[model samples]
Target: MKTDSLSAKAKTRIKRPPSEVFAAFADADLMSKFWFTRRDKGLKEGETVKWYVGSDDGAFAFDVLVKELRKPERIVIEWMGQDGNPARVVWTFEESEQGDTILTVEESGYAGSNDAIVERALDSTGGFNQVVVAAKALVEHGVEVNVVADHVP
Candidate 1:
């Protein structure tokens, strides 16, 4: 079913500089405030870090290997997603002349039938939408809407 060809992308324009916007995703500590509840370390090239989400009682952990890390621009990571299958996620930041940044997140790879893969991609798209929205709120306005955290039980 060409799982390799199925990728989900979500993008948003944040009312902040690229570096500031990128920090929310590249720095583990800063990331906790906007998205993904916690992480072991910041995103760095060739490094693998453990990231956590959900509440204390419902914590979900995943190992992410930073494939590429370009400050204020892009990040690429591979993690065990899609029911333990490896998936790649890329984050890109394009700064506008007015100091704002356009942020994009793309995730690909999975194991399943065509329908299952399509379903997963759709779910990832929605989840990424929540991620970017919450990130914008947190970074631009210092508000945690919990858009990602509140989605699950």
Candidate 2:
């Protein structure tokens, strides 16, 4: 697989409407069901929200800056990357042929040495891959995959 890159994208078809899928992301409580364990607040334009994640080791938190928000359509946010660099994540919601939501997530701004950048990019790509799949299970089947938490072990 191609590794060395500054950005990565993951797309998935969710058997739900755009609004429902969007709520899975925009609403902090719903997001905890699939991705981060919890957050300080829901997403809002011009605001930075703290997202806490759980793992076998313990829990850690990160800040996600909501750069843009467009209801059941799109959202853009910037999260901290290497040494204060900001990595941008853009999530888009599209209506599919069956009236379901086509969710797309793209993250960029991987920075550092050649190997460092590639490693970070690969992790981000893989992480997002797991996230969307977990989200699909929760939103479509109401199953908590515990994906991110189980990533290490």
- TM-scores of all models? 0.90, 0.88
Clashing pairs in 2: none
User: How do the residues 5-82 of candidate 1 rate in per-residue lDDT, one tens digit apiece?
Assistant: 998899999999999988998877778876776646677799888777765855877788989999989999998874
Give the local distance difference test score of model 2: 0.84
Clashes per candidate (backbone, < 3 Å): 0, 0
lDDT of 2 by residue, 1-153 (tens): 333457877999999999999998898788887788765567889997877767334578788889999999999999997467678899999999899999999998776677777777778889899989998998999998877667783
Residue 126 shift from truth in candidate 1, angstroms: 0.3
- Candidate 1, residue 63: Cα displacement in angstroms equals 0.7
After superposing candidate 2, which stretches have Cα over 4 Å from the reference? Answer: 1-5, 55-58
Flag regions of model 1 displaced more than 4 Å.
Answer: 1-3, 55-58
**Per-model CA lDDT versus the true structure:** 0.84, 0.84
